[model samples]
Target: MKKYFLIIVIFVVISLLGFSIIPKNPFYNINWSIMSALIIGLAMLAFFWNFEKQGVSSKEVALIATMTTLAAVSRVPFAIIMSFQPMTFIVMITGYVFGVQTGFMVGALAALVSNFFLGQGPWTPWQMFCWGMAGVISALLGNKKKEFAFTKFIILAACWGFIHGWTMNLWHWVSFVFPLTLKTFLATYIASFPFDTLHSLGNVIFSLLFGKTFYTILQRFKNKIIVVPLDNNADIV
Candidate 1:
């Protein structure tokens, strides 16, 4: 637990340091976004390792890996449409099914891996953060035994769309805008509103149609993975 706490501390410290240094001389040349992303990714990996120590089964690991891969690959089909992808929906579903930790991993990894095909830059880390947080938020709202509400899912998806756009725009605001005035920040967000809306709508559509399906699938996998103890005398018999 201490190690996990330390990893979180390191992630936060590195993020603040990276952002603080990005616009300054001697550090301006460094890709702070990439650096931050790597740092956070490493921290998440540490958390995942901790999860193993806490008895995360092999099947759970496999499930998360498979889900992350699917989330990344799901973006390929919507490559032409900017920000119109099922990745967010998939990540949220994972969160809803598996809870916050798994959701975050799926979300962060999806962005990192998908960028290999989509291309990575300063935006990669922001994408990871936004998507990862989105999953965490979704899991927070999810119920363990009941089906997640479709209406709530749509609302959350829409909210995350705006959140993602605003967060991504922050990168531009930080990297390009001098002094980082609110006016410039607002301008960037306003300009990207249409794209954000489309992304939100895409999320709503995907969630409405496929969210429950994904959850059901995950539940089945969870059921299969449950360690059913054998009767003590059964083997002897």
Candidate 2:
């Protein structure tokens, strides 16, 4: 547990330092997009390294890849919908079923991969972080329950929409918004309210429609991957 907490602290420290240094550094000619990507990539690597130390099975890696692909692909069709997408629901469900580590990987990878079609920018890292947090939040909320709580997840997903948008808005505010103040902060969030609402509504809808199905499917796969040991001295057929 201390190791996990340390990993989280490292991620936070690196992110804060990187973001703070990027805009102010005049000595190096670094592209904001590239620099930001590098920062987020390193932070994500810390988490992945921590996860790797846990001795992941090949089946677990494959499962994570499959879910990441699914989540990424799901976003493509909704690219034109202005913040409305099923990807979050998919990532959240993955996290709820698997655990936080898997959830974060799926969410972060989905953002990185899907941007191939959607266009990558400085926003890419922010998207990765936000979506990754979505997975973490879902896992925490589920609390290792064997059964999916549909109503609870639906509400959480709805709230995550706004949460996600507000978080992304912080990047915009800090990176671009001039004269950062209370008024500007409020304005930024206010301007994003409608889009955030759309995101939230989309999450609620997806959760209502597919949350249970996805949960059951993941749970089944999880059970199949468990390696049960045979009793010692058991007779062979």
| lDDT scores in order | 0.79, 0.85
Tens-digit lDDT string for candidate 2 (49-100): 7787887889989999999999999999999997899999999999998889
**In candidate 1, what are the lDDT values of residues 110-201, reduced to their tens digit?**
98899999899867767887788778888898856476577877888888888888877777776676655788878888899999999999
* Residue 4's lDDT in candidate 1: 64
- Give the candidate number with the greatest TM-score: 2
Off by over 4 Å in 1: 3-53, 143-145, 228-237
Candidate 2: give the clashing pairs.
Answer: none
- Ten-residue segment with the worst summed lDDT in candidate 1? 27-36
Clashes in candidate 2: how many?
Answer: 0
lDDT of 1: 0.79
Global fold similarity of model 2 (TM-score)? 0.83
